[model samples]
Structure formats: structure tokens, C-alpha cells
Target: MDEAALREMLDAVRSGAMTSDDAVAVLRRLPFADLGFARVDHHRALRLGMAETVYAPGKTPEQCAAIVAELLAQPGSSPVILSRADDEQAAAALAANPGGARTRATVVWRPAAERAERVVVVTAGTADQPVADECACTLAAHGFRPVRISDVGVAGLHRILDAVEELATADAVVVVAGMEGALASVVGGLTAAPVVAVPTSVGYGASLAGVTALLSMLASCASGITVVGIDNGFGAACAVVRLLPSAVTTRV
Candidate 1:
């Protein structure tokens, strides 16, 4: 339960609308809910300022639906986000609660009210769109509108140069690239915004399945560049969310 929900429950007890015993029952379930296959953390938002998200790689569609349904049932729970969800998993989640939206590899339900702060998601090339899309969707799920800057890798310096004004306005910047990951350094050097770099597995064999890019990002000449694992768009987005001010993040 969030602060608002906790206060409302206390008020109900004070006004005699809810018995003390009834309030205790609700509080008992606030910590977690056991679903046999999963123990859903209902108190996550209260502790972390954001709800727990589901990672759908190894889970069955039914399991995903069950977890999502339980989360939605909690009183005052924030939006539920599912990352790396395949088409089947996405369909099952939406079927469990028809009030949800999906992007390429992400699904969200009851997204929190959008915040005024913005995040910019920049992709190195077309091959990076999949990872970039996941980053954008995750940011949206967390209540931030992400401005997408596509195909702006260092190969065409002018492309990224053209986006300097747009990038400057973001609260944070997420740079997604493969193949040496030089884009992160370039974007980092150009904008004062905090940079969260994502290295994708989108290059030749010498790229070592994104290892080269990951290493390059780690050794970036540009200051203030943080790197996530290969193809980990979701992680990149969470990093950006943490960079936002408490006023924008604390609400959800």
C-alpha cells in the first residue's frame, strides 16, 4: 500500500467505517501474497517508490498472468510492468486484465500519471531499435515520456549533432548501441544530462556478442557515462528513473 492508501485505511478505522479487526486483516496482506508459484511483493512501492516489475523470459504465460492479476488486485498498487514479454505472454497479461498496453517487448497496466520530466532514448542504428524500444517503453511505464532519437550513431556524427538541442532538455539520456558503443561517449560529451548506456548484441563476430561494446562503454572517455549489460534495455530505463528528482519519482 502507498502512503495515501495507508492513511485512508487509518481514517476509515477512526471514523468507525472499518472495524479494527478488518483493518488488521488488510494490513496482514500488505507485506506479500502467496500464489503457490510466486510470492508477490505487495509492499514494494511503499519501500522503493515504484512497484515491482515482472521479467517474463522463463515464465509461462499463465504464470505471468497470475502474477500480474495479483498485483493489480492489491489496493493502491502502482502500474504493473512486464519486460521481455513475448507475444503470447503479452496476450495473456492483457487477457488477465484488459486495461493494459504493449510495445515490442514490454507490457504495462495502469501506468502512473505522467511526470513533467523527460528522458531521451538514443539509438545507434536501426538494429538497436529493439533494445531502444524496450528502454522507451519502460520509461513510459514509469511515468516519463521518452523522446526517441533514432539512427544517430557516431558513424554519422551530424545525426547526433542535429539532436543536441533535443538531448539537452532531457532529465536523463539513454544511449543504446552495439559495435564498440562509441555513441554513448559522443552523446555524453554533447549533453550534460546523465547518460545510461546500453550495449546490444548487434554487431559482427569480433564484437563478441556485445562484449566489445560493453567494454567500450565501461571505458568511455566521456565522464558520467554509466553502462548496463548487453541488450538490457529494461535495466537502462530503471537507471534513468533513479536519476530523476525525488519529487517526480516519489509520487509512484
Candidate 2:
């Protein structure tokens, strides 16, 4: 449960609305919920200002669905992120438990309050959208607005320049690129905000399936940018969320 729910439970007990025993039952699940495969960390919301995220890549669809179901059963309304979810797995899980017509495991959550301090997710081209989408999804789940600038690679410098205003105001920038991955360095030159470069496995034989891009990003002359694992959009997003101010309230 989140802080709001915890407060409400205590307030009810203090005002004679809820019995002490009943409150005890409510508080019992604060730390976690024991699923056979995973101990769902429910307390993360209280500690990190964000709910525990589900990583759907290595897990079976049923396992992923079960974890999400447990989280949805919590007392407070908070956003959850499921990273790298398999399309088929997500469909099956959502079909089994449609989230009360309001929520969708696939439908990302966006906060209206953070429209101004939104993160800019710049993609080198269409091939990078999947990794870019992963980054954007994580940011959305964590209550930050993410604006997409597609196909604006170093090859097309003018396209990126057109978005100077949006780039300037962004809290952080996530640059998803493959091939030479030169976009990150160019973006780093332009923006003062921290740039998180993600090298995707979207290159030719000589590119070494992103090894070249990875090395290029690591060796960037840009002094202040950060680099994540190859195609680790979730890590990039988590970094962005840490840079953002603590969220004041849980979003429905």
C-alpha cells in the first residue's frame, strides 16, 4: 500500500471507523506478497516513490500476469511499469484480467503535471522505436511526460534542430541509436541535460550487432553524458526518474 492508503487506514482506526484488528489485517501485506515464484515487493512504493516494476522478458506470461494481478489488488492507486513485455504475453495477461476498463498493462500512464519537464526520447530511425518505446513506457509509468523525436539521426541534423525548444526544456534525454551511434554525441553537444545513450542490436555484420555502437558511446568525447547497457531502455528510464523530483501523489 502507498502512504495515502496507510494514512487512511490509520485515520479510520483513530476515528472508530475501522477496528484495530481489521487495520492489522490491512497492514499485514505492507512489506510484500508471497507468490510462489516471486515475493512481490509491495513496500517499494512506500520506499522509492514508485511501485515495483515487472520485467516480462524472461518470465512466462502467466507469471507476469500473476504479479501484476497482485499489485493491482493493493489498497492504493499507483502506476506500475512492466518492461520488455512480450506482445503475446501481454495480450494473454490482459485478456485474462482486464484492468477494470481504466487500466491496461499495455496502455502506459502519463502525468499531466509533468508535461513541462518531459523527457525527450530521440530515436535515430524507425528501427530504434522498440527500444525507444521501452524507455518511453518506463518514463510514463514513473509519472514523467516523454516526447518522441523519430528518425532524427546525425544523417539528418536539421530534423533534430527543429526540436530545439523541446530539447532545451527536457529534464533528461534518452538517445536510442544503432549503426555508428553518432547521434548520442551530437545530442550531447547540444543539450546540457544528462543524455542516456542506448545502443541497440540493430546494425550490420561489421557493426558487431551493437558492439561497435556500444564502444562508440563509451568512448564519446561528450563529458557529461551517461551510457547504459546495450538496449537497456528500462535502466535509462530509471535514471531519468531518479533525476526527476519525487512525485507528490500516486496516479490512478
Candidate 3:
């Protein structure tokens, strides 16, 4: 549970609207909930103002569904997220919790109330849209309105140039790029806000399936650029979220 939920529970107990035993029963599931193969962290939102996200790579469909369902069943308004879930896994999670909202490889439920943070998600090319979409989706889940600017690679400097004013307005920026990955560096130079770079596996031969882009981002000409792993749009969004102001929240 988040601080808000815990506070409400305690208030209810104090007001005599709920019995001590009932409050205790709700808190008995605190810290985490054990479900054999997994120990779902029910206290994450209380700790980080963000809930634990389920990554569906190694887990079975049933496991994915169970985790998402458990997260969705928590006592918070924050959205529960399942990332990179395959069709089967997505189906199971949806079946388990019909309220979920899906976007490509990401699914979210109970979207948090919008926070007053300006964030931007920029894509270097159309091929980088998937990574950008994931980043935008995560930002939305966290209640940040993401400004999207797509297909603005170095090949078309004019495109990014035209959006300079918009890019400069964000509290944080996430640049998703492949190839030489110079877009991140350019965006970094354009805005004083933190720039989180995400390299995608959307390049040819020497690009090394995003390794080259990752390296280029690491060696960016612009100073103070934050770079996440290849195709790690989620991490980029998390980086941006961490930089935002924190408040007590409930588990999603």
C-alpha cells in the first residue's frame, strides 16, 4: 500500500469507522504478497511512489496474469503496468483484469491522476517509434503528459529545428534513436532539462543491432546526457519520473 492508503486506513481505525481487526487484516498483506513463484511487492508504491512493474520475458502466461492481477488488486489509484508481454501473456492479464489499457508492448490500468510535469518523448526515426511509444506510455502511467516528436533524425535537421521551442519546454526529455544515435546529443544540446537517451535495435550492419547507437549515445558530444540500455524505453521513462517531484502515493 502507498502512504495515502496507509494513512486512510489508520484514519478509519481512529474514527471508529473500521475496527482494529479489520485494519490489521488489510495491513497483514503489507510489504509483499507471496504467490509461490513470485513475491509481489505490495509496498513498492509506498516506498518509491511507483509500483513494481512486471516484465513478461522469462515468466509464463499464467505467472504474468497473476502478477498483473495482484498489482491491479492493490489499494492505489496508480496504474499497474506489464511491459513487453506477448500476445498470450497480454490476453491472460487482460482476462484476469479487464480494466487494463494496452499500447503495443505495454499495458496499464488505473492510470494515476495527472501530475503537473512536462515531459517529452522524441524519436529519431519512424523505426524508433516503438521505443518512443513505450516511453510515452510509461510516462502516461506515471501521470506525466508526454509531448511526442517523431521522425526527427539528423537526416532531417529541419524537423528537430522546427520543434526546438517545444523541446525546450519540457521538464524532462527522452530521446529514442538508432543508427549513429546523434539525435540524443542534439536534443541534449537543445534543452537544459535532463535528456534520457534510448538506443533501439533499428539499424544496419555496423550498427551492431543497437550497440553502436548505444556507444554513440554514451560518447555523446553533449555533456550530462543520461543513457539507458538498448530499446529500454521503460528505463528512460523511469529516469524521467525519478527526476520529478515525489509525493506519497498508493500501491497500484
Instruction: State the RMSD for candidate 1.
Output: 2.0
Instruction: Name the lDDT of candidate 3.
Output: 0.89
User: How many clashes does the backbone of model 3 have?
Assistant: 0
Worst 10 residues of 3 by lDDT: 243-252
What is the per-residue lDDT of model 1 for residues 192-236, given as tens digits with 9 covering 90 to 100?
889999999999999999999999999999987999999999999
TM-score of 3: 0.95
Global lDDT for candidate 1? Answer: 0.88
Candidate 2 lDDT (Cα, 0 to 1): 0.78
TM-score of each: 0.94, 0.86, 0.95
lDDT (Cα, 0-100) at 20 in candidate 1: 100
Candidate 2 C-alpha lDDT tens digits along 1-252 = 777678888899999999999998877887998998999998986777667877777889888778878887788756655556667667755675575222223333222234356689999989988888878877776667788999998888898888888788877999999998989998998888889999988888888888888999999998878888888887888777767646454345
Full-model lDDT for every candidate: 0.88, 0.78, 0.89
User: What is the Cα-based lDDT of residue 186 in candidate 3?
Assistant: 94
